[model samples]
Target: MDFFRIDLSFWLQLQFSARVALRLPAAPRSLRERTFLVPNPILGVFLHWLGGLASGSFYVPYRRVKHWAWETYWLVGGFFSWIIAPWLLALLLTRDLFAVLRE
Candidate 1:
């Protein structure tokens, strides 16, 4: 209903969709299959740009939190951005996530 909830929901959905998409099986070997397996340089660049934009803008939401001390706001934001979101995303995206982490 609110912006935080909406944003969180959107992020969760997007991550889940990405994980599902990435899990699709590759087609058997062929010219087209080889082409598909090759990472597109343009798409790679675009993804990096998008990630930079997202990281740069991550603190924008904190600006709307009035009456909060800077440290309080920053710590709260940092916990979500650095800890919670990454953990949740990794759990969603990876098979044997705990095994990978343990290694």
Candidate 2:
């Protein structure tokens, strides 16, 4: 039972991470260009909705974690979700990531 719960939590985390990655490409740089790059308004709306769903459900996986301090698990998750993943995606998506970050 414990093993199963741990596996489920990891699976949920993976799903949540994938959802976040999918949403990264939809990040809008400017208000004017918000819906321009996307082919249709509906598609943009759907992407935004999906991102919201992912954000809302992201904490569900953490609930399954056991035998650890909340801060310990949160910090580990935060490192991946907030820092490493964003930096990696920005580097992949942007031409001059450092220049963009410096501004």
Candidate 3:
């Protein structure tokens, strides 16, 4: 659909801009270094490993699940992963979750 294409294009543009902005500047000799508060490179490696583990194992568990259609399983997995996990984590971790969400 046209709306989906437009939205995807906007998201891709945003991602590309983020990638560009996150790249290091060429001319450096400044005494002060700016940051985006990204964690250490070691943490990035561990995060990358964890993500790869998750994605690699994504479809395997579905094979053990009998009787459900692919669409059903996919829908359930996507719903919990995209919606439930983040909300649950935030609720558990944040001090004032409702106020932050309201903002």
- Candidate 2, residues 21-96, lDDT tens digits: the string is 3222332345323221214688789999999998898777777687779898879889888999988999999999
Q: Which candidate number has the best TM-score?
A: 3
Q: Stretches of candidate 2 above 4 Å error?
A: 1-40, 56-64, 101-103
Give residue 49's lDDT in candidate 2 (0 to 100). Answer: 100
Report the lDDT tens digits of candidate 3 across residue range 28-98: 43412322242368878999999999999888878878789889999989998999999999999999999
Give the better candidate number (2 or 3) by lDDT: 3
The models' CA-based lDDT, in order, is 0.67, 0.65, 0.68
Ranking by TM-score: 3, 1, 2
**For model 2, what is the alpha-carbon lDDT of residue 69?**
94
- Global CA lDDT of candidate 1, please? 0.67
Pick out the ten consecutive residues of candidate 3 with the lowest summed lDDT: 5-14
TM-score of each: 0.49, 0.43, 0.58
Stretches > 4 Å off in candidate 1: 1-40
Between which residue pairs do clashes occur in model 1? none
lDDT of 1 at 1: 18
Q: After superposition, how far is residue 45 of candidate 3 from its true place, in Å?
A: 0.7
